[model samples]
Target: MQFADAKERVLSLHQQLQEHNTRYYVLDDPIISDAEYDRLMQELIQLETSFPELQTADSPTQRVGAEPLPFFEKVEHTSRMLSLSNAFNREDLMEFDQRIKKATGLDQITYVCELKIDGLAVSIRYQDGIYSLGATRGDGQIGENITQNVKTIRSLPLKLATPINLEVRGEAYLPKKEFERINKQRADNGEPLFANPRNAAAGSLRQLDPKLAAQRALDLFIYGMDGSSEVYTTHQETFRAIKKLGLKVNPEWKVATSIDEVWEYIEHWQLERSKLGYEIDGIVIKVDDYALRTKLGFTAKSPRWAIAYKFPAEEAISILEDIELRVGRTGVITPTAILKPVVLAGTTVKRASLHNEDIIREKGLLLGDHVVVKKAGDIIPEVVSVITKERTGEEVAFHMPTHCPECNSELVRLEGEVALRCINPACAAQIREGIIHFVSRGAMNIERLGEKVVILLYEHKLVSSVADLYYLQKEDLLALPRMGEKSVDNILSSIEKSKGNSLERLLFGLGIRFVGSKGAKMIAEHFGTMDAIVHASEEDLLAVEEVGPKMATSIVTYFKKPEVKELLSRLQGANVNMTYKGPKIVHANDSDHRFAGKVFVITGTLESMSRQEAAEKLEQLGAKVSNSVSKKTDFLLAGEKAGSKLKKAQELGVTILDETAFLAEIER
Candidate 1:
């Protein structure tokens, strides 16, 4: 095909994909199936490959992502993203109404009440009605540019109906259904679960890879915008205007003239919040009139014209039937309370995590005892307390397991930890969990080998360890339940693909004690090869910055085990890449690195570099970057609207540096 024809086809495909994205994401109506979308995408990709000049920044194919960014650059907001004061109860709401009325010198007021979505706050900017820049709410005045990640969110329109330049504030959230699905997937893969929907949304948005963000199924709700120059006169009208321009505004907003009416709206939603798709922690009450809101003015941190009414946590009562022990990848035996099924926060709760023995004892939990259960963050179910008054004399006190439930090995509580752990490396439960973790998304990322598939493989003795995955035959996988020819082929393909993952992925998959993804990456980059890390002593490991005593010891301990070494040899024999494929890290002592002796505490968004980048740069220069500000801190790296850390630094007489100054210092 000619270049012109390819270009035309690519343009047509982009338009089709954009429309489909809008329909599926914003409208919740899909006209095409996943297979059809994949076919279109493949055609576009081939066209782009054949005619490279036809590729554009706004093309649908670009959403797969580029190289991982070293850091996110900060963008200063045209206007401050002010927070709202919280009103916990009806009395607080009444007081907020009175305060607003007093401040505006008016008795009558109108408010636009919106759901205070429990997710990451974002600012999306448009230039000539085209989606341009997007940022996170980092200290209100400055935010990290997340334009690429924002573009991956299908509900977010790439272009508006009108060609007017404007900025809108929205909440980027993962729906409750998606959150549950992802968490269950993670649990099955033996990965740590997301605590809540809000946290999951935040984590998804902040992902360095836009493709990762895209897979999260993120949605947005544009509630407010800088409407000072707009034709709209009220907050209620502004919502309608944005919605007309292909923006998603929550459909449940209400116009309330009286505080009592506002209370009624809040009370109704508090009870019905579970019925909604997304999570809302509270309701935001804003003065309906834009002119009135302007007159009301703002406080240092929050707008006087707006207030958030937080809902009280909901709870339900159920009988604790039994306490069951579940083994984790780390061999930690967690006690879960199996309860009589009771509905709480929209879902039926059958079990609640008792956490550890201490929590069980503190809660005085017993078998067959009536207990109050609640969903923490509308996701994790937990026993709030035992209903002692309802408990009968027949109740039996719960106890922690003395032996591994699956392998029957004696469990031991590690020094400095509360939970009992099974230290047997060959334990069936630990081995199964470890293999599952090895194939998780953040690790080897074997797509078709999910938790259930791994369990099946393990049960049939087809796979015992991570290395065994690559050795599985077609007949072995085909013999398992639900394993068709296509399924077996897909699993084999994914397993083969995982062998090429970077060294950090392998290190993380190994389930090293006290080593997380970040630590794994640092070790991988610093050492360059898994062999180097395996041979390194604790002292040698400690030489690399970010390698604390605990992590260094853990790495040394992990590589020292004969079983671990044997596993590594097997993986090596399987032709798995054992070298770092990502960027290399240079030691501070290797060169004349600036900021070598300085200690920095970053507070807000940096204009040139992401917070992680800044911290990494500091580490590369031998600086000890800490999360919290203290007397020991040499400098407080303050950005726009720097919070309590800035104030604390000022009080402590620590040097404060803006993004520009911080950059200059590093350069010097």
Candidate 2:
């Protein structure tokens, strides 16, 4: 095809895709099957790839991602993103209503009830109807620019049908299906999985690479707007406006004329939320009248106009048939309860984690005892309490395992620690679990490696350690049941790619006791290289902040192992990155500047930056960034639809800054 002809075709295809996206995401009325839409998208991508110069920022294909950023630049918002106060129950809701009535001197009020989505909050800015920037809710004032990643979400509109400059806020979430698929892939790749969809959504949105974010299949449900454009007037109107602009709005949103009605909606959803494709922790109730909301005004952190009604935790009773001990990759023995089947939340519970020996004894749990089971975060099932009265005299008192259940090796409890750990490095279960942890998304992130694959590899003796993953041949992988040629190739390619991960990732993947991603980064940066870390003494390791004596000892002891040394040697031979070059840090010379001395709190998403990148930038500028808003906070950087922190910041009278203003200040 001629260049001009191809360009025109691409443009037409983009327009068609945009309309399709609006129909499907915003309206939930798809004219084409998913397969057909994918085909069209693939065609457009191919054409764009062939004619790279013709690709535009607003192009539909651009949404998947661009290039990795060196660092996120801070952007200030024009209007401060305020959060809502929490209403735990009906009484809290009534109190909020009474407070609003007293302040407004009105007998009744209208509210916009929305699902409190358990996902990442983000701000999206559009200029002249074209999608421009997307950011996380950094200290409300400043946020990291994540426009490319936002565009990757099929639900997010790249260009609105009508031209208007506006800032829209929403929750970016991974649907249940996508979350399951991604988790399955991670599990197969011998990777640690996200605990829930919310974490997965947050993690994906914060990725520096938009392409990686795109692969996670995120979706957005716009709930509010930052400012008035040619859109609508009230919170209720904003929902319609967002829908009109080809943006997805929550389907469950309703206009409640009275607090009682709002309570009814909340109560209904509290039970029905599980049926939805996404996770929702609570219900958001916002004043429907935009002018009234403005009149009622906000506290330092939260707006008086809205409140979130959190659902009461779902709990059920089950029988504790037995207490089983399982050794983790780090050799820590975790006590699991073998329970008589009971439903908690939505899924059937057969096993619940006891966490450690301390929890087991603290609960006074015993075999054959009736136990109260609850889902924490509405995800993991936990044994909340033991029904001691219902327990038979024959019930057995649980004892902590003194040896590895799988390998029968002697277990030892470290000084001042409650956890009994199997110190055997070559224990089969430990090795399998270690391999899974190494390739986890938060670690090396080898896609297509999951638990099943790890088990198969272990059973076939194809993989004995984490290093053996890098050595697996395609033929060897294909030999496993249900493993096709393409699947094998994909897994092998992902494994190959994982070898080039950063030192921080490598550290985290090592499954060191108590060393998470943040700790890994700290240690990797402090030590610079793996060899230095391996050779460091406990005293040397303890020099790092947040590294306690126990953690330091654990690190030192882990590296001292002959198995770890051999694994490290093999990884080094495989060309894995061993030296830490940490993420780009932004620093300012003015230490006592307005923002420098201030402590800022951010919740929700900004239209331009990721939360982590924004926090890092603020820290570099001598500003303290706190997770929750408090009186100590000097400013609240609010974005889009902020949560509790915005409320507390308001109540504390902290200076609130929007994304645009934050950017201006940081740049200044």
> What lDDT tens digits, residue by residue, belong to model 1 across residues 407-438?
99999988899999998878899899999999
Every model's TM-score: 0.54, 0.57
Candidate 1, which segments miss by more than 4 Å at Cα?
Answer: 1-15, 31-54, 314-668
lDDT of each: 0.83, 0.81
Error of 1 at 522 (Å): 35
TM-score of 1: 0.54
lDDT of 2: 0.81
Number of backbone-clashing residue pairs for each candidate, in the order shown:
0, 55
- Number of the top TM-score candidate: 2
